[model samples]
Every structure is written in structure tokens, then in C-alpha cells.
Target: MRYLFAEYVFDTDRRELHRGADVVSVAPQVFDLIDYLIRNRERVVSKDDLIKTIWNGRSVSDAALTTRLNAARVAIGDSGDEQRFIKTLQRKGFRFVGAVREAKEPAEAIVADDQVEVQKVDLALPDRPSIAVLPFENMSGEPEQEYFAEGMVEEIITALSRFKSLFVIARHSTFTFKGKAVDIKEIGRRLGVRYVLEGSVRKASGKVRIAGQLIDAVTGAHLWAERFERDLADVFALQDEVAVAVVSAIQPKMIQTEIEVATRRRPENLTAYDLFLRSMQQYYLTTRESLAEAIRLAHCALDLDPRFGSAAALAGDCHASNVALGYTNDPQFDRKEAVRLARLALRIGDDDPDILSRVAVILAGMVGDSEAEIELADRAVALNPNSWRTWNNRGWVYTMAGLPEEAILSFERAIRMSPVDPLLHMTFLGIAHALIALRRFDEAIVALKRALRHNPSFLPACRGLASAFAHLGRDVEARAAAARVLEIDPSFTISAHIARSPKSPKLFIEGLRKAGLPE
Candidate 1:
């Protein structure tokens, strides 16, 4: 039988695989592994199964198996990061996830290899903003300056990629047009990007100049342009300056333009980073289904790259958030998983501010208030004060530490840092919590209302509204809010909620009782 998938034809009888006209070379073991995976595609294939079948029960180290699997992926235009063909399930096993069609006869019988052609892998744009940064022109006329010019473009690409909202073509793709006089439109179309960033770097007389312009490839209109010059000693600083300027300038313009960017949305073909971004978007939706989907996608990303601290942290956050929002039936299991994943993320990315903040938040929420958590959050914010997530996590640490005033201030800073963040609801909820702790019932209600505006079905906001209304002697509204909470989270009970939030104000608990919530 011949199996066909993603422009690749695998002829089992011939023991060969062909991608369009190209025959993909695979080691004997790797080929067997692929064959096993494809045959067992209906179910996950365990390591033992592979070792028993492919190796005839011979002992194989974990690393050896991983290398073989990676080789198999590469031979088929798949990758560990994308896992488009083979998927790894944590603690379960591996499975072939690609869509495949079967051919009873050999593929060579239908068409010759020379007549076959594969569609470009990146022919379609992603469902978000996408851009490509071409290599900066090295105008210095010195070969030594080439690295610096290339480095500047790389720096900008890295910074822009961190935004998660933007789809950045890899350096390998954009560098192909390095010395070529390619039109911006051609570059965009070839790269499947809506925007193209072109720049020039010149170094002379102990100084360096870097100029960059962002252009809408569709219309060939320059969206934004800036130039910076600095001492040679400050080249790294200049790179950072240019990156920050481009990031700050481009995002707002993309938002204002409301660029209808995507041409194709292939959820199954998402890379690890793409899956992470999708998980984050689901997380920001703040719904029970969304949170569950977020965890699933994060797990897939984690499986693709076990060392991906961001994916582990995101999965941990989802587990913690489920408990926080009363979306969990098994709190103990969720709590354990949340703490374990947080620590894993910490071990992998202790120095990353985003990971530190994420771990800190998970620890604080799942493990309760701790001095270590406060320090972690503070360090994260100190490392990246510009990140609203770091500031938001700092706020959470303080809230759990019983510093309501300080927590409120930190939350306010987070809001200012990202005024239009999709995660705004969580920040607003943090403010509400701090205000409630301070006995500022009216202000707390306003903050809770704002949170509900972002996520109408947010159980925590509904619960907060119940307490705030009860405190204000608005019995009807209090009961209504309490009902909403139960509607959103059927498992919500006063005692369970109080146990989860040990730091809840006594009045808040009393109000829950007054609002007729289950004891």
C-alpha cells in the first residue's frame, strides 16, 4: 500500500518515500519508525511497542529513539516544533496526526516523479499579522560590518516575534533575498507575509547608522520608517533601540489598519509558537471551554518541545486558572499538575522574565501566599518592567501577600502598560480583589463590572459582584449576581471558594452567605 500526505508519497512495498519529485532519504530504523507510526495512526504507539516491533525487543536509549523520531520527521518535511505529521502526547505515546489517503497501487503507476510538483509549504499566510525582515543592506563597504547589519535585522525579528500577535518568517527564509534586488510585493507574496521590513546598516568613523522602513506589501506604501545612529561602542544598544522602536510603532499601526491579514488558517499545521499563541488567545477568552482548549493546545506545544518553558508555564497557568475560576472538579489533581508544570518551567527558563512571572503567578494561586513567590514576581518585574504580564503577576503576588494597596498599584501599572490587552479582564479582576480587601465596595464593584464587560461569563467577576452588592445592601442585585455565579460555575460554594482564597476578607465571606450562596 502507498500512503499519501502533505505532498509526500510513502510506498510501503517499495520501502520508499517521495515528496513530489524528491525521494526523501531515511535511515532503516527511522523508516521503520515512520511506517509503524503511520500504521498505528489510529492509536498512540508506545515506546515499548516501537522497540518491540522495530528493534525486535532490543534495548534503545531514550535519546536514540528521539533522534530517530526527529530524523523521520525531517525526512517528511515535518518537525518536532510543528509536529504536523507525528504528534507526541505527554506520558502517553506518539501518534501520526497527519491526514493520509491510501493507494492500493504504487504511486509511480499513476504519475512519474518528474511530473509531480509539491505546493510551496508556506504558500498561505497565518491567521494573524505576518511580516518578514529582509537582511539589512550592509552599506559600510567593509566585510566585517556584514555581521552587524545582519544582526540588526535578526534583533528586530526576535523582538517582533515576542509579541505573539505577529507571524514572523524565519531568518532563513528572509535571508534568501539578501543581496537580490527584490520588490517588496514580491518578497511579501513569496514569504506569505502582509508586511515587509527592509533596512540598511552603515558603519563608519566609529559610528553606526541603522535605518528601517515597514511597508504594506499589498499597496507598496511605507507604514512607518525610522533611522538611528549611535557610537560603535553602542551597537548592541542601537540594535535594541531599533527593535523597540519598530515593535512599538508597528503594532499600533497594524491595529489601526485592522489589516485583514490571513489567507489560510490551518490549525493542525501550527508550530509550537503558533500553538502557544493560540493557547494564550483561548486563555484570554476567559471561558470554561476556552480554558480547556487552551490547556489542550499548550500540552501539544509542550509535547513538541518539552524544554519549551513558555508552553509548560502556559499549561500550568491554565490549570491554575481553571481552579481560580471554579472550572475544576478535581482541585487536588489540578493543583498538583499546576505546581509541577510551574517548577518544570522554572527549571527550564529561570532567567526568562516571562517564564518567571508565569511561574510566580501559578505558585501563588495554586500554592497560596509565599515569600518566595513575591521575590520571584518582583525579580520578573525588575527584569522586564515593560511587560504588562510581569506587572500583573507582581500585583497577584502582593494580593496574595496581604498587601492590597500595593497590589492595586501594581495592577494599575499593568493596565497602563497594556491598555488594550486581551487579558485586561484578569487585571481588572485583580484590582477588584484588592479593592474588596480594602473594604472599598463601590470601587470593587466598578472594577468587577469592567472585568465582566470583557468576559461576561467570568465566574469570579460574578462572585465578586455578589459580595460587593451584598455589602452595599443591594439585596436584589446581590441575589442576581449570586445566581449568575452559580450559572457560570455550578460547583461554586461559599466554603470551597473561601478555602481556595484563604485571604478573602471576612465581610466578603459574610456577603456570600447573605447573597444565598451555598455554604
Candidate 2:
């Protein structure tokens, strides 16, 4: 793909930049950075977003990024003072203001045409287990309750989506099967998924009922099934409970599901719990107003039963989301409340993987409780080995504890479980970081490239790639990579990433400096 902007033409496929008749020789890394900027010229990219995209969440410094950006500007006849084409945002990132035009057919179309003969290539199925959540049928006579039933299916989808080890179809695409009587095999083929979840919901006489079954769509085998009944007042709670149960039942190795079903009994009155569960569905959507509404509904459930650990944990999740997403003005206050509620939930019923996993995330991210977080994450994984979140959390703990190799393994497991997951890109970044720590520059570059394939905007991957190039004496490519990072985050300093890193600062800095980062 070639992006024509002003008088300059950037050939992404060839990794070349052209100015009219002159071939402007730019380093491959610089070419990549310019290509990304031109491609994403529509919006102001943020630092975190860039890091996530370019680096795959690997650790890099602000100085490295700045040095590269300066070099890129020099290449383009643009300067920090002139600010003609690429404009840098203070806390945000960068924006390419030049008008861009494609110089060739779309890359997708070309690739499709070239690979048309190989399109029918059949590959072996992955060794990992996979499943999909089908839309639940609405047994309620009222069409207004469609949202309620849809909400139930959506909740299951979200919960399952968190399990990176599971291949779940997106809710938007999966819900298309609603109100249709389709073959499970057909659904699997259409979605490129292995398992399908089918269920029905019926509300009658102030009582709610739900039945769900998991099917191995390819083999046409019914892997798991369950039915639940609850008062209409607690319908929401029942839905959440059922979702958790269904997740457990589908995973052959999760024995805790049986224990939970055998020992934990539902509350006598389900009304408030139902409302809370429904509200949680809203909360998971991750909108500001929705989070507030979720909190309100969760509080209502607590009013009915202050001892409801699930509801309280969810409430804490709401606050944490609010704070994490920058929705709340006072993160400190929200963080404190989130920790308090999460702790309360753990105290009430810490054994539940759902509750423990939630608490573990809060403790690790918000409270910095490494020991407790690792323990909780370990327990969560022990309870549900197929859980993506469990592995993600474990990887997170390892990263923070400076155990990059362990973190890389955990992330690799997570990626194997959910190859298409956006977050799995971070695992690739983790691998690169570990490789870099072990002084394997070539391996780090390879891993970073893999991560960039998943998310082109990942800045950490870009930085790591630059470090590798620098260490290998590929100054031009290293500078270009560093420039791309700077274009995404001007304040990005290699020193800072090393300082904040959980690993040994001296060793981290030594490696980065050797990789060509300016002091």
C-alpha cells in the first residue's frame, strides 16, 4: 500500500518513501512509522493506544521514542518548530494532518486475488478446545422482554469472552442466529467456531426459568446442559448464576462447577438479585452512564441482601471500570471503594473463581497486592484451567514481579486459547520483553513483529523492535522504530519504562542503551 500525502509518497509494501522524482531513503522502521501515521490520519492517536498497537505492551523508554520522532521529522522536512505535517499532542499522541491518497489497489483485494488458488487450503484444527455462545430464545410472550433474554445471552457472551482460552463469536455476529432454527454444525461453520451454546428463557406466573445446553457443533455432540428456576424478582441473578454454571459445565476439566452446584444454594427470594444481575449486564458494556446505573442496581440488590458477594464484587468492578477508563474524576476515591468492596466480596465467598478473579485483578492493578493477587490468580486458574482471565492475571503478576519468562509462558498459553483476542497481542509483547531481558535481540524482534501483526498501533512492540535493531548495529532501522514510538508518544522515555519496570533497572537500562537508546 502506498499513501500519497502532499508531495511525499510512502510505499508501505516496499518500505520506501518518495518525494516527487527523488527517492527519499528512510529506514524501514521510520517507513513503518510514517506508514502507520498516514494510514490512521483520521484521528488523534493516544500514547497508551499507540503502545498497545506498536509495542504490544512491551516496556520501552520515552527517550527512545523521542529520538526516532526527531529523525522522522528530519526525513520529512518537518520539524518540532514547523509542525506542518505531523502534529504532536501533549498528553495524547500524534496526528498526521497531510491529505493521503492510496497509490495502489487495496492490500486486502490484492492478497485475496493472489491467494485465490490457496484459498481452499485446509489446515489442522487447533489442539485447544473452543466454544461459542448462541443467543438464548425468549420464552416470554412479550416482545419487550426480548432485551431481557438478549441481555442474558449477552452476559454469557461477555463472561465467556473474558476466557481467552475460549474461542467465542462476537455478540453482534452470534446474536444474528436468534429466532432462527439452524443446525448447530451450520452455525459453527459460519462462525468458524467449534462449540455452540443454545438455550431458552421462559417467564410465567411471576417465576423465571432458563435452560441451556452446550454442543460440540462439529461432532454434533451435546457436551453439557442445565436448567434453572427462580422467582421473577431474582431473574437477573439467576441469569448470572446460570451463565457461570454453563461456562463450568462446558469445560470438562472444571470440577468446581459440580461443587458449586452441590453446595451453594440460591437465595429464597430472587427479585433483588435478578435486578442486580441484569444491572451487571449493563455495567459490563463499559459506558459511563451504564456503570452508574449498574452501581445503582447493584446497591439495590445489596439493600435486599447485604451479604450478596457476587453483587458486591460486581459493584466494585463498576467503580474500578469507572476509574480505569477515566470516567471518574477522582480515581483515588474510586480505587479505594473498589478495593474495599472487592475485599468484602472475597471475605464473603472468596472460593468462587469469578469472585476471586475479580478481586485478584483489583488487588494487583489498583492496590499492588502482588502476593495476594498471585495467590488468588493461582486459585482461580486451579478452579478453572480453561479460564483466559486466570492466565492473563497470572501473566500480569509475573510481568510485575519481573519474571518475564513465566509471564511469556502464561501469555503464550492465553494466546493459544484465544488466538484472535486483541489482548493476546500483549502476550507477544511480553515474550519480546522476556527475550530482550535474556539478551536475545533477534528473538525479541521476531516476537515484536508478530505482535505488530495483531495490532499495528502497539508502541511497545515498536520500541522493542527498535532496541533490537539498535543493539544489532542497525542504527537507521532502530532510529526509525524509535521515531515511530515518539510520533505516538513524544514523552515516551526508555529511561522511564526501565525505571517503572519491575525488573532490575540497571540491567534493563544496560540492554536498552546497548540497543542504541540515547541516555
Candidate 3:
């Protein structure tokens, strides 16, 4: 792949940089950095992201990173001050601001074999985990079942798209493969996804049978396969059921597979969707460093596709998390920026439950916009009631609004829907926080402990535990919890926390003050 920008041509296949017939002598790391920045020019690249990509996640000092970035700029006839090609964003990262065009390699005919090599595709893979649902094969004798099969595949695509975690190809793109014989490996390569879902829809008499298989597109390994037999009377309902079952069955598989692949590639080779998936994987850690990296990755995704609502929502989410957990001392600036991102996401993805839920949680929890948060939360629930994230977000809004009863109910519903969710720690923390508002110190302590058990480093749980323990007169435990909070986020101060948490009631704030957090 060749990228041309300004007077330079970067040959990714040759691993060379050229400017007006002059080959630039760049260090391996510098070349990788420039390549990454150019390939992902759609977003900002952070120092942490640089270390992860160029140094393979090794520790690198700020001065060293700055020097290397400077070297990269010099090699490309650019500089930090000039920023003709690379622009820096304060408290964010760096973006390749130069206009670029990708030159495609000539396409070759794809061979359908066990060892498949796909011809180059025009579209790049997304930064998030992506899957293409090929149009379901119509196996029934009657050709009239074509719409039934197409409808089922389209429904599945729509259902999968609701998951902020997975990137689902649109029906129009996937349907292009309808009635065609294609190689799974080629499909995987062309789609730039690790997994693919394919199935057959059969309607016989009054009954319907849907058989689906989830394949690891990279290795042609069958991760899962399922068949459902249901009444054909309610076609849409059956489609919904099959879609839900496929998503539930394959979600865990996709996560595990992505984790294995996460460390195998550099940013230069990743698509916008791949970057988004990487961001989400890191975001789940919920640590200060991880949040920074996640935010940077999310921004990179947005750069590749600025209108991506999920990426915008996650970017806002990271900003909100930064202030909510006291990761930053500058609450006002972070709050303003976070609200701006959330508003953009809301406008772009008004109907997307994933975006709506994230925006609602951030606006309600960090910005303290009760009306907007509540309305969005309600809309998210109505859009996808089965989504645990939607329920979890709604609970957050209620907790922030000081409605303990409603908050507790919403959290419980979220837990019921996704009992083993990695983020269950968050729901437990919400219940604990709400319990504190209700003056149930003992119950709150138990819930906080449970949350800590799931994720010991979760700062919100630690802070809540401290408050609950103090309210219960367990001074020793309270001090221990407060110490843990400091350990996770040394910048944490009661004043900063209070400023960010606009929805917290007076009683809840009082408990934290009693718990020995510095004002």
C-alpha cells in the first residue's frame, strides 16, 4: 500500500519513505511511528499509543518519546512547532493533519480454497472488532423464501450493530455476496474481521429452521454452530430470536479471540474498526493509564470516521471517567469537553442505543444534566431493552439523580441480563452508592466489597467502600479504602470529586468527607 501526501510517498509494502525521489533515512521506530500516524491520520496518536505500537508496550520516558516524535517530524520535513503534517492536541494526542490518498495495489482473482488469498478490498477494516453477516442461504425449495432469508440476515445485522462492542457490516455490503460462492478466508481478509457469521434459512410448510455458524475467519476454525426450529407464523419474531441467540453465543468468543489478536499487530496495519475494538478492550480496564490510552484510540477511530457515534460516545466516556474518578484536577475543562463530545454523539446517533446509553451516563453522572440524561436513558431502554449496557446506563443516571430506589432496580435488571459481565463491578458499585444514599451503610458496604472483589482497582468502588465503612464506624476499614483510592488516583481530592459529581446527594458527600478523603 502506498500513501501519497504533499510531496512524499510512503510505500507501506516496501517499508520506505520517499520525497521527490529522495529516500529519507529514518530509524526503524521512526518509520513505524510515521507509518502509523499516516495510516491512522484520521485520529490523534497519543504517547502511550506510540509506546505500545513502536516499543511493543515497553516503558518509555516522556523526553524519549518527544525526541523520537521530533526525529519523525524532521525525517518528514515537518516539526512540532510547524505541525504541517502532524498536529498535537493538548490533553489528547497527535493527529496527521496532512491530506493523504491511498494508492491501491492491483487486484488479483481470489482462489476459493482451504488456503485462501483475497484480492485487495477498497474499504479499510474498522478499528473495532468487526463481523460481516453474509446473506443467509435460501435452502427452501420455493424461491418465495428469498425475502424470508434476506429479512433474517438483515435483522441479524441490525441486532448485532446495537452492540457497541462489535462492528457489524451493513446489510447492503454483506448482501453483495448473496447467491455467490466465496472463500471464508477471502471473506475474512476482504472484510478485515477475525470472525464471520453465515447461515441457511429454510422455510418448510408451517415451520422454519435457521442454522448458523460462527467461524474464526483467520484460521477457518468453527467457533460455534447452532440451529433453531421455530414456528414460521411470526417471521420477524423468529428473526429476532435467532439474532439474539447468535449474538449471545458468539460475543464471548469474539472477545477472547480479540484479546489473543490484540498484541499481534501495530496501528499501521489496523483499520478504523480495528482501532475501535482495541480502544474498547483497553477501556474495560478502567484504570487511569488505560483510560488515557482508550481515549486516544477512540479519537483515532473518530479521525478515520469522524461521524462514528460509538467512537464519539466512548471518547466522551473516557473524559467523563477521568473527572468522575478524579484522574484530572481540571474538572471544568474536562466536563465541558466531555459534554461537547456527548452532544455530537447524540446528534449523530440519536437512534443508536449504544450511543444514547453512553451519552446519557456521561451527561447525567459527570455533567449533571438530569433532564437530558433521563430522556436519553429512557430512549435507550426503549430502543433495546435487552441490552445490559442500556439498563446499566439508566441506573447510573438514576443514582446520580439521587433516586436510589429506581437506580437499584435498573442495576438489578442489568445484572439479570448479563450476570457474568466483566463490568458487573460497575453495577455493584452503583447499587452500593445508591444504598449509601438510602442510609443502608451495612448493605452498601457489602455491595462495595462485592464490587471490589470483581475489580479491586475500580476507584469508584474503593471510594464508596471508604464512605460506607466510615458511615458504619469502621474507621480502620474506611482508612484502608481511602488509602486504596489514593493508590489508584493520587490526584483524588474530595473537592474535585464533589465538583465532578453534580448528582450526588449531600448525605453521600458527607459520608466521603467523614471517610478521611482530603478536601
CA RMSD of all predictions: 9.7, 27.1, 14.1
Report model 3's TM-score to 2 decimal places: 0.61
TM-score of each: 0.58, 0.40, 0.61
**CA shift at 258, candidate 2, in angstroms?**
25
Which candidate do you rate higher for TM-score, 1 or 3? 3
lDDT by residue (174-233, candidate 3, tens digit) is 665677898888777665566789999888879999999999877999988989999988
lDDT comparing candidate 2 with the true structure: 0.65
Candidate 1, position 129, lDDT:
68
Residue-by-residue lDDT tens digits, candidate 1, 336-389? 999999999888767677888999989988777589999999988876655678
Candidate 3, residue 451: the lDDT equals: 91
List ranges where model 2 is wrong by over 4 Å.
1-349, 358-370, 471-473, 494-506, 511-519
> lDDT of candidate 1?
0.78
The number of clashing residue pairs in each candidate reads 0, 30, 12
Q: Which prediction has more favorable lDDT, 1 or 3?
A: 1
